[model samples]
Target: MATVSEVGELLIQKQQTITSAESLTAGLFASTLAEVSGISAALKGAFVTYSPEMKEALIGVPHILIQRHGVVSAQVAEAMARGAKYQTKADWAVSFTGVAGPDELEGQPAGTVFIAIIDDHDEVHIAQGHFAGNRQVVRQQSVQQALDELTNLLSKN
Candidate 1:
């Protein structure tokens, strides 16, 4: 898997922009990219939508979709990616939504996460991960997972 810095460098190399819609990992994915020098060329902006309401309000993720799939499901993750991509007009958009805590959410155990990536063609790719760790570790892993997925996608085309 590629590191966050590698992902940032790839984005700059491709001249591709990216945005994020974060829930479980908060804004960690974007912040990690920000740590890379000159990442501003490809890093667009991010929405820290920790709540379902904000997910709907800010990105137009339908409430019915969330109600049906739960906040941590793959469907919500894809919607988040598509919405973020549309809103930001970025070449790529990554979304993180999950349970990362000592408590379960919607029957999902802690460390259960759903990540989605939307490419420039409007194609969506989703992944569900079960990471094992504490809350902070889970969050960090989720961000890394997102970066890895984006890096792989970038490498493809």
Candidate 2:
């Protein structure tokens, strides 16, 4: 995984800001970014929507989306990224939604994760992954993946 400082430096150089809407990983993605010195300049904010209601109310993840795709789908992840960008007015946004558990959720097995990144132009990129681990490991891996995905996308931009 790239160091948080490296991600921070890249964002700073690009004059771009990022926010996260996290579920299974909670706020780990945001916390990781904030750990880097000078990240505040390009780290806009974060929303830890660990529940369906919070996702709906805070990030505008429509009830229909969650109902249609469940909380752990790529659609929810994309909605979250776009919603975070709109809510925080950041140049970039990333979102993670998944079943990180000792058990399955919405009929999906544990480690079923989806991540999405939305850029300033509203272009979105999403990835779906299945990991192998315990709950904590799954969550940690999700966070790392979210950061890595953002780093890759920003680098390409």
Q: Rate the local accuracy (lDDT) of all candidates.
A: 0.92, 0.89
lDDT measured at residue 57 in model 2 versus the true structure, 0 to 100: 97
Local distance difference test, candidate 1? 0.92
- On a 0 to 100 scale, what is the lDDT of residue 96 in model 1? 96
lDDT per residue as tens, model 1, 7-101: 98998998999999999988998998999999999988999999999999999899999999899899999999888998989999999999998
User: What TM-score goes with each of the models?
Assistant: 0.97, 0.96
Q: Residue-wise lDDT of candidate 2 within 84-114, one digit each (tens)?
A: 9999999999999999988999999999999
Best by lDDT: 1
What residue runs in model 1 are displaced by over 4 Å at the alpha carbon?
Answer: none
| Residue runs of model 2 more than 4 Å from their true location after superposition | none
Cand. 2 Cα-lDDT: 0.89
- Measured with C-alpha atoms, the lDDT of residue 24 in candidate 1 is 91
